[model samples]
Target: MSTDNITKEKFVLTITADSIKSTDPRFDINNLGLGDNYKALDAKFQNASGTIITRDYKKGEHRNTNQTMAKLAFQLFETQIINLPVEVKEKFPVYKENVDSELRYGIYSSVEDFNRYRKTREYMQYHYGDGKVFVIYSWNVFSTILFVQECLKRFGEQGDKFILTYREKDIKESEAETLESNVQKELDKPISEYRNPYSRKLIESKNIIFRGAPGTGKTYLARQIAADIVSDGYYDTYESLSEEQKQQIEFVQFHPSYDYSDFVEGLRPRINDGVMLFDLQDGIFKKFIAKARANYENSLKNPEVIEKETLVQEEIISFLNEVEFGVDQFKTIKGSIFYISSVDDKYIYITIPENNIVNKLSISIDEIKQMLESGQEFKQIKDITRFFGKLFATQEYFYNFPIFKAIRGSRKKNIKPTISTEKLKKYIFIIDEINRGEISKIFGELFFAIDPSYRGRLGEVTTQYSSMNSKVEKFYIPENVYIIGTMNDIDRSVDSFDFAMRRRFRFIEIKADSTTAMLDELSEDNKDSNVLDNDALKDEAMKRMDNLNKAIIGVDGLNENYQIGASYFLKLKTLTFNQLWEDYLRPLLQEYIQGLYNEDEIMTTFANAYGYNETAEGEADEAFESEG
Candidate 1:
């Protein structure tokens, strides 16, 4: 049989017999069989004739023409095997090269001989594809028989065990999982177990006004609520929104001069061609609107479903263009823009033109456009009424003034524009000093904005004040936003908050106390001797300090008083026994008496409080010397 031009598909070659039986070394078949073997002569003739065949050679024919057989086998192997797939080829270039070179040599006779084929490719491909192939001399040879037996043993075994043992490597473990678990545990713990009543009420109501004497933790509670809001994943829903539409939260402080310009927007200074020019600058409300617009735009990009502000400038312009020309035409109009005038008589006006004959006299489209373009125009209207109204709403003449047309117009419309409550629910606004600010001045038309009953879902409501020049319209607040405020109860300049403002916030009180777990935790001394005997001792010390504060106020004539809070106690613990008398005890005694009492009075107070005192002002030095 000829090995050349072998095109048999799924072909296998196995040695079945051997004709050489001589043990004599002199009987050379290489010389004899080269001419006598009929099958060998036929294979050579068949190759010359270009006929395809699968050939099996006996041992005598193999040894006689091993050199010619090897050459022909190499050429046949090269043309027979397909090149490896690209991914496999890439990972084992050297193995591929060695396999191609070894096939050219035809030296493989056993599994080990094929493995000598080199390169991880040969090993991977051999196992991954067809089972191992063996080249044996003849069926009767012991070495060839053993090689075939071993190849058969490995052919049917699982390939994965071989791959794991020889091809793949193991990975090292990481500490990140442990660290993440610890962090998650800490985050899962609550900040405080106690439920804050004021926070609960504020959450339930649309608007709540905090009113209380100083030292109450109204602002603290507000901050706590803000923290809870941020941590509880409430704002995560807003994350899907565009940067503009999510602008649901805002905070601004109100003062005597905090007019409409500061709350909405105004024209301010800018340089154009080296000349100072007035540029339109957005106020807190307008700034917030811009942010909401951005958020809305972004939210639209997300795949998730979320609330978005659909109103655009084009819609607003279209609405303005659709209004009919007539005195009563402006009565039914609605949009986002509204004008708020904060005079002694505060009122909100919608941007639409009034229908009354007296109100529609000389209003122009140009004026309306100007109001839309520059927020400062709205500020000017507010200033005109504020100057005429004397900044206080309680003045009878100002309330009755007929010239306050804009203020009267807002009152006539009954509409009060406010941030929608739907917008408020998405973000948080923190006010640093809630009590110090003028609530009425800051809230402007939004007094109604914070009220739940007048929220955005309720639509527009009109109210009439006076009819001097024109009537005005204003819209209601939306439901999505929230307000958080902080206050230092210690400030004295402002009188107690107004009742109307008080009704809009929930108040929570924070007081100095000994029973706090945080205080006990901090008081534990890790150094040599513990200054506190136990949690009970710390509580007693706090009580005594409070008593000392009361005694000081009782003895001192000044209304300005001081309390020995937790901070003072921390400082007291830092002093040595002798230093405590001189630095803390004596000074406290002197402060208690308002500097009226002399050194003896101070020493007596110290002895009364601590049951011990330094012998004299400087006697601690002598006592130290005596002890030494």
Candidate 2:
């Protein structure tokens, strides 16, 4: 075989594509391929599954080389499979030094556009077709590869964001599985094995509490459950989730002082321009529940209705932004001239400057939204008898119609709007150490709302600060919102959780022995990669954990609640078996036996079971005594 032209591609470092696996008599990229030198080569790309389409360029073979790939790229552009950005010189930053001098790709919309530019005509003609554009919107073959390489490096820096810009409508179903679908399945496989049951239970129950001995990975497990549920089994771990996916889950750690003011809505103090003011603010849970409710309700809405509602809301906001507060004057249906006075989240207040009355009119933003959504734009007020079931008085119509028309006519439609589809999403709210706080105080009215049977409107309750709200609609938890609470069975504060709240949640006991599967993780990516070494450690860990928990249950006052967990055994990663006992296990066990009558005796039994050498310690103590 010839080796002169054999070379690696610049852009595609690895293509572990599942799509390529379906090839008839599937071959690896390393098997056989012609490289830059136009001669047969082996192992041009190192990937096991997918092949590297080597960017072979020869002076005489410009038209023949990579013509198939170049044509496919052009087809993707024509079908709007992936829209190319309008080329800007500044946007294409110079990639790392590939071959001495820096070069940026020359991208043009079409061949005629490419011909108009005289600068890179010679460069384009030699490497690619004389007047054609190729992959990454570049006319030069090498530049196309360089473009992918440069942008891939930058996108890789974004950590969890595996960014791919595309429009949803542009994609058409293909024979091969998408890279996204494949990657999601790969990410979610391990998680589903362990936490899928927990995720399912949380969804079915609506509220769940994981009760376990300390260090049994209750909090960690809750996060995995949330990630699994939120990503629809695509992502397994919380840390693996993209930022947008993470928005569907909320984590809160409860403490002694956590109350309704922190969990639900409350009067929070704030400082304005000079004086201090108390404002009614929705707390974390309320805010998150509201978001979940909106998502759930929006999913149920007719797409056309949702789109129009969005358009009206957007237009109203735009109108508000353009209007000068207390300056812009407009006529009502009754020829009343009102100047815009102020605007809040719900209402837009306006004052008739020429009126004898001092009061300002409060126009309902919701009403205008309803009018545009369901009501018509009649030229006369008599034609509008009623809007959204509210029989508006003549004066009421005078106050609203003019503002409605102004907002209705001001629609710009700038955004490529996205509306919610009928597929409802699950939102998980995980509260760690839920019993640590006074549950009655923290949950307040929410205790009624969170019940599984009464999940939706049936469970609605007036919140503590409902009186302060502009529109006090009954607050309810959405059907899609699930709560996962983790509690240590031995925590003193567990008594603070009332029977009412207890009945609402399905409690599952997580034992020290129950979490043994997590110990399997320690064997991976540790000091030794040998199968025997890893297996030996895992077996030893499982054996010691079993022995220790057996001894723990034997203690009269102690039971499974005080048993040592697999999390403690995970110290086998950095600590010896004896060191693990002396440091983490010993201290925690000592605390459990602090005032017990048989304290020393119980600890001695535990040491013996865990292979701790008390006799060796006794000998060392005796030697020190003799020296003294």
Candidate 3:
């Protein structure tokens, strides 16, 4: 149960030389003590700093010694002191800490000899290669080097020979550490401090699908999970993020006709130079991937250099102009065709009165700019523009001028890598009703790149329409980009999704039990004082819903897989019980039972289960009471 003794180990050192072919074998370098150079070896050792040095000479006898070498292979580990396998790290608690401290682990050898032996592929298989005298340096590499130097000096006397040795020991955890004790300490931590196990699985898998019935907060939770990843851990609820942080997440939906042109890069018709022509345009996923890649590459750069690339005022002005220019169309008093002629610091001048008369009318942009600069509301400009004494006044048309222009900046400049506050800033692409799309047809060649194992630069591919663009030949999904999808499992459309996509995505089911509480939070307060308070209605609604689902699952043609989720009851805050049953629930039940052989009996059973009868009402009350 203790790791005190596990960290300690003993090692022994040995030295030997390779044999040489000779007519008189006794005179070879291998036969050191018997050779004539034995006298010179003694003299060479005498010159060493040691007090006395001598060599023993055995006449006419070849001394052969095969000494044991200590195990120092574990020293090669760089990130940690111990070169333990991943299995060992997972099995032992002491090895799991982010405890990084200075510890000894390395292999040392004669550079010349290692290079010489490296020519042969057989010798290359060895960790340090076949050196003349390989030395593995552990904790006492400095002392070991001095010892080897003296040996090399004496050995050189026999011939032009070199001696080298490397020795190093792998240390795990700390000098004073125990695996059992560490694991016990970790277990002692409160449950709130421990991360969710599923988060780790999601990180490893990279792609996930949240399959359930409609309105289970699948898209909502996807944004939160995506934020958690980029922040390195769950920082707070998604609502707490600053406007800038929220930009890192994206949401999209998929339908039957959605194809590669809408999800990846494709040639699209655009009015370029007054001529309609197809030009390459990046789709939502591709655009997000490009942003993520830029952030990732910028993270590796020096912050000072990024700071030198100043945020000039001209660039900001240009950006503002682009945002305003995007609003090509406008609305007027007659409700049709007004073109935004020009947008300047003072006014948004436009040509108005479509199809009959053409004239210029200007609305002051100062109010909108003030609303942006100071987070204060401005009084609605009354009687702003008048034409023919009609007194035209549309607040929305004048106020909301800068469309698609949401900008947030950090106070500090280049304080962190990846351009100011962003480092490895991730982008999440959430595909709602994922199964409704033709998966293979929509993703095109991106299917290979989207695979979890093949993510990042390793999976880069030349896109199908790459030839259309002069500069770009390849595209890749960065590691910081993630995909989350949601669908109803019972939908017939689910069957049309490609098998290849199914294998790539980790499927996580959102069930009624996990999401029904959302309804209670929504119906917490009654909007109108005249209306009856329905704070407790969610429980009653859920009980009837659960009972209906049970009947649906037990039906002859159906099973638990097709059971309805509690999302159907979310509108109880404003809807009456009678309205929900008579208008919505009854018709939905009828549709579910329409194709069944015993249609009449099935409808009767469903209606009763949904609290249409006295027996069903009693059962619902009993279930709710027991749950409470």
Candidate 4:
């Protein structure tokens, strides 16, 4: 994407998703006068001109991945950090590939070195056209993690959000592929076979609102997008996430009733000793923000500092692992022998516990460490209950607490925060049905904080209930936290997202066809004969959908947003095709034409176009697909 075509007012940052860019002159190695390069060999020799850079080779895949963690970072910067525009996207920075940078930053040592790299003589002679070889170190393209970092840095939620695609290879193998080519392959992959690159890139740069028709799988896609970013493109499906990884995401459904108090922070009534009392509580967004901020801060901490405080915990863990299981070496407060089973970062498993109701019981490592570090004497379950509050006040604590005490009694070790390694983790906040709520009422002063350019301390908001805070502290969303919202184009709420708040987010139209990948789940490739052949059924569904959508668009107000999405056909999982049409699709279409001047005629047109026929009540289930 060139600057001439960009709408400078479109967003606070602009990201260009060029095809994996080898064909572009930006990646051509001999394409000299290129902006810059990285050179480690003659470090200071070329700096006399004051532009050349010397960087060590040690910044390998980790550096690239972080830069490619396009999801973790945002668009590259246009100017100095402080000069970033808050209300509109920054001016596109003028960038070009230069010989100095190509030598310093590109994969090859220099343009000459790249030309000389040919261990695969036959392959190069057959496949490597002189201009086809892509190797440049220009302003990163394909909306790179480097570019996202530069562009989206305006919005600051600091966590390691990696969106990586490059693979490691031995340079000596005479590699035939370039990083741009590898990325191109990924981008070109079909939706059913790959994550949506557009969604990933959009959410990376700023908070996104997905506007589309109902059944577009907008809500589902929104969460999946979050999972993809949180995984740093490692995994896209939300179900694939482990319990620990799932904690990085939070989902909320917005309704007309949702307000600032419910979203930001509010007071809830709590009965304390029989008297009703109001207590200030963190809203879901605020609570999630706290977690994101903790990770962001920990990621910034010096590893050596954390390690210094973690030695004792490390020694205790080593001793526990070294101990043999099934020996009945540890005992509970009742003196019932229990054997150690396993230990992980967070929990300890014990085998053959006195409580025979189950084979083994797991205990928290941090809780034990917390108890140990407190220097508090525990005579009974009450002490554990007092320390951890009501959650651990159960009978399970009675057994587990003593084992922790027994283990610690022998080792005399205390585990601190250092026992848990710090990593930059992405936190995703997803709001389904975002348009249902009145944006201004729900967000209030957050409109200022939500701007991509105003992230961090500069965008801190003294929330509505500031007096409830201990010190009237200001709250800010961290750089690592990303927001995704879904909206139906035809929602009837009187109050909608305010224009100002709309400007704070990047809005993308999620057309019905763009989300047909959802239909892949309905496939029954080798099921019983009674079930319809999935491929044929899918094709039929797609054909009918196209006819109906094409007809709908011909109407005055109806457009792609009014068309049906693949998600509606998901009913084929249990409901038959006719059942889906009559019960679901028909009613939705009727509703669409309810107030039209030719309501009945339009409804008939839609039904005919959709191929609806009550006579063939059991219309053979047709396969369906959506792609853009």
Best by TM-score: 2
Write down the worst ten-residue block by lDDT for model 2: 161-170
Model 3's alpha-carbon lDDT is 0.51
lDDT per model vs. reference: 0.37, 0.64, 0.51, 0.59
What is the per-residue lDDT of model 2 for residues 67-179, given as tens digits with 9 covering 90 to 100? 32333233323333224365552255422224444454454545345545533222222223454443223221222333333433433222211111111111232211232
Of 2 and 4, which scores higher on TM-score?
Answer: 2
Model 3 scores a TM of 0.52
CA RMSD (A), model 2: 21.5
Task: Assess candidate 4 and give its TM-score to the true structure.
Answer: 0.55
Tens digit per residue, CA lDDT, model 4, 439-556: 8888888888878766666578888898643235688876677788888888776245578977777888888898787777766542433555666566767777789899999999
Residue-level lDDT of model 1, residues 88-125, one tens digit each, is 32232111122223211222334344445431111211
Error of model 2, residue 422, in angstroms: 4.8
The order by descending TM-score is 2, 4, 3, 1
True-structure Cα RMSD, model 4: 17.0
Measured by TM-score, how close is model 2 to the native structure? 0.57
